[model samples]
Target: MSYGWLDDDTTISTDLKTTKETPFYEPIVNNFETGGYNPSVSYHYNPDVTQYHYGVRHPMKPFRLMLTDHLVIAYKLYEQMDIYKPRRATKEELLEFHSDDYVKFLETVTPENATKLAQTLKKFNIGDDCPVFDGMYDYCQIYAGASLDASRKLISGMSDIAINWSGGLHHAKKHEPSGFCYVNDIVLSILDLLRVHPRVLYIDIDLHHGDGVQEAFYLTDRVMTVSFHKYNGEFFPGTGNHDETGLSKGKHFTLNVPLQDGIDDESYTRLFKSIMEPVIANFKPTAIVQQCGADSLGCDRLGCFNLNIKAHGECVKFIKSFGIPMLVVGGGGYTPRNVSRLWCYETGIMTNMKLNHKLPDELPFRNFFQPDYSLHPNLGDRLDNKNTKKYLENLKNQLLENLRYMKGAPSVAMQEIPPDLQNLTTDEEQAIIDKLNSESSYDEYLENERYWINEKDQARKHELVE
Candidate 1:
């Protein structure tokens, strides 16, 4: 079964003609440069995050986070990054993005009392798609906390990149759950980023559309959400269309690279770079939040794309090349074994560590990678590529046309950051940051201006010294 428009060379030709005739704006040069490549990465994890069970028959599984963690340890990739058992996200943090009603519902409702709260569950859309499992509220806190902690680390100039495999619940809404997502961790983390970052770019490579996060920042110009996903024929979260650009102040900020089933590695990467390069050049986001959903890989139980693990990871590598402070989080991936493989591989990429093809002999879930036991197993093509060259070119042209509306990166005047949301570092952590600043000539103090960390004081101190 294939999707996407059938071969329409004539329409493609006409579209190309109109695009070329339309006077395109000169490319905007991106100025938000990273001082230098700092591979100081932080990894957030908590075993309890992977302990909750969605349901016996449900496709969503929390155990995949454990599998991913075990592989990272087995490959010794954990040694390359600073690891922290994240604290559970408080109701206050959840309130930053989710509604108070939704937060209270998740905090109170559980499997034992779910029957009593049937009416409430229905109101919040917490049925089959998002089941009220044991310790469900706790699960949400753990994952959401990790992403918040990860964002704090970036905002404090303590890490260049942060990873939280349990985060990236992109489909969760402001007052409801959707598509197996209970909390919009991605949105919360991006909200944290916006406290200091002038502009943030959110990129989701999940098989399904990142509707919840898109909706959260749909009306804002400060955060640009770009989602690339399979969008055809009543797909899950039927959004992310060609013409579904942003509204009013957010015009042309929301970019959707809708794809068809069975897109190959070369084609996916080519299209990704083509659209992202121009978008980044124009948007010039100070920070990036990427949702790496492994379900987009080949053989994923619920996915239709034929992308292999490598192709999926290529997106991470491409984003990393930009050298922007980033937070990488996981999203949908049903096949547990492959999810572990894909995320573990991406973790290595973020840490700049090259992992071997063979699965570690000491891997805890060794049996999962059965038969071949290879890290990059051949996930043979199960669907034909319906995204033809012409179709992709048309998408690129359309997206580029949209980008032409932005004269340049919109300026964001400094705002008074809420004191509660500010990054507060401990004395011990401050010592490490001070030592790094003294040793490296990267001017960590100047960089802190970009993060707006103690901005007024830092500016005053520099002025006095001058």
Candidate 2:
């Protein structure tokens, strides 16, 4: 069997007999019929993260996580990946990136005492965007913990890719919260990766800028953050701009692709590949952390981009082909229904399972997907594509020019691989060990790197030969 580049339909063929190695390329052509999937993808989720309510009027809903999980189960996508209910993040773990004062405040603050602590709330930027709700502290721990566990799995060589749909709260700062995010789980997870990997790459596809994450690693070349978001004007937490690269040692490291409104799938993907291909080559990061925010999809309540579910997922498919250890997390999505659909679809993408378009009858909240009970619904054209070809060409040139400044992928002096933290393994540790022994090692998998060296040569060449 042989696999080629992604086409319009996003189909690719691969040798079915190849050992289950990286979670990226090997495709189970008919997983639904065979009940098989790549076992290297570990899914870290806790049901408790879905139980918390952010407030009645607030757009950020934890219930969407529940919906996404239900959809994954209903589609039998869980059969493809190892699932674990990760532990809540300890205060010590949170302190790795968050300040002691802020960590203590998140632990102690509650709605009952919020009125009296108005001044404290103001200081932390937790007014309307980041409100004090019941179980808010516990909720933050659960999500942050899932992300930490996901990153740990990648670092320990236990999983090729780990995902936490409840994480990716990228708007939270070191000492304050912003844009409905209370904890910067992405930042915390990246810090964890830096312990083992010399360099880490962060790519954010949220409709809003990943300001909190960009700011956290702006001064260090150890982590390179690339955020593609709707920029300019009065966008909330507006910071991502083409000119706002990085500072000091990290001058050319942080790359921001500031897009205009109503960018469609073709244009969005073109720019994504154009910029990402070179960035990945030049940075040569060992691990990657991608924030797959569903708010960027078309018809989202707050998002202005005109991307469909398939288009949004194309980014994940392209990235996975690189065969890098990755941690995927959730971010700013207002339409809970679409958010659930987008994430569930992406989960299938990660596990290399081709999902059925029709929603399963047994899926919970089935009625919520009314009118058309399909995974990829027609969100219709709500906004015109403001991004012209000329504008995109020029923007691509500017970003590529900046890459020329970098001498090459920064080299790190060889050091001893850090010992794994002294944490007890979960109940399924033995089963995981058995699976790891049966699969290919990390070095062997990287040796078989299936990369598209040139975007122009392999753009839409799709075929799954068998």
Candidate 3:
């Protein structure tokens, strides 16, 4: 009767602004010069760009923007709750997952080496799906940093969950890159967590199999790689068969649920609930790594399945029910506008955070796509589909079968205490507090000290002598 894990308290008013006048007039009128000023004034701005519009010519552009928008929305909503803030990942953290040679190669890739590297596509698999772009290294670093920060949060116990929507580059290999992923952030984060927890479960529900991550931990019992993806025959990188369990100590550790194409939401939910719940319950993993790829949705150019956004939300909510300190990563999604909405909605569902649903007065993609209170026009209707019950049944059946195949492993629960909390001294805490205060003071100082570009512009000068 009730949905997976979410309660009725989850719903919120879809309105972005409480009232029309409140959105436009309040911020401007409350300027410091007016007595209605607040102690501190800060405004968050979203950029409007031509490339991010719905029908942008570039293939990756829209998807990239979609990821950004979802993250921005999540940031704003959580800012009100004061839940979690994103931070950059450090270099030391990156080395935990990436090979030294591969890391160095990424750093050295430039205009000169890029052309030469393009010639060596077979060697690195760089040109195939993961092409060497102009700023490929920078983007990899940024993604690596975000993934690292997420790991840090988990390790520090700052939050029970930390998600980097940009970080799940699952298809990237240790030495060779593939499938639009350069350095595998998922792998990196897993390795970082391994230092703290002996066992980790990585569950990927992307349409394409998580070949890179599965390969990295193929022989290790410490990590379990479970992926449910479309396996219609060597689709892209071509790995992850149900029979390909782990080697040696990793036997039965790697689980693959390769589904046929045209699979719908109901089937997905059944399979997820039945298989994942029992398997995870039996294994009793110390932490969870979930990759929520929007490509699994219907109409996504790259994906093969036909799952709706609600099904995706259901999966996230189910995962959150485990209540473990988990690191969530974003993976594939080609349909930019829809994917962004899907991810934004998923974030709220997983974190138990509410959506404002208010349209930012000037969204970056405003001119390109019409804005409705709901992220998508088709998804606006609240009516439940007739096929939902049947789909749920199908999903439950698939999950039941998959669970039978899984063998329960011994539960090794590692108590992980985050390094930040363990290491911070009273003096360190005071220093951080003082630093924040100093930064705020400096901001106030800069705001008050205004500079005139041209002194003449400040005072109108009319030469009567002329």
Shift of residue 27 alpha carbon in model 2, Å: 5.9
Per-residue CA lDDT of model 3 for 134-231, tens digit only, reads 65666676666666667766766665777677778899887877777777889988887887877789999887899999999999878888898877
lDDT of each: 0.86, 0.86, 0.65
**Preferred candidate (TM-score higher): 2 or 3:** 2
Clashing pairs in 2: 13-464
Model number with the top TM-score: 2
Q: Is candidate 2 or candidate 3 better by lDDT?
A: 2
Ranked by TM-score from best down, the candidates are 2, 1, 3
lDDT score, candidate 2, position 68: 93
lDDT of 1: 0.86
State candidate 2's TM-score.
Answer: 0.83
User: Worst ten-residue run, lDDT, model 1?
Assistant: 22-31
The regions of model 2 sitting more than 4 angstroms off are 1-39, 414-419, 423-466
lDDT (10s digit) by residue, model 2, range 1-466: 4533322243544564431322322244744543443438999999989889889998888999999999999878887898999999999888989999999999899999999998998899888778999998899999999999999898878999999999999999999888988889999899888888999999999999999999999998889999999988568876888898899998988888888889999999989988898899999999999999999999998999999999999998788778789999999899989999999989988888777677776788899999898888976478998889998999999999988887678877747765445343654666677778767576566554443334335666584322
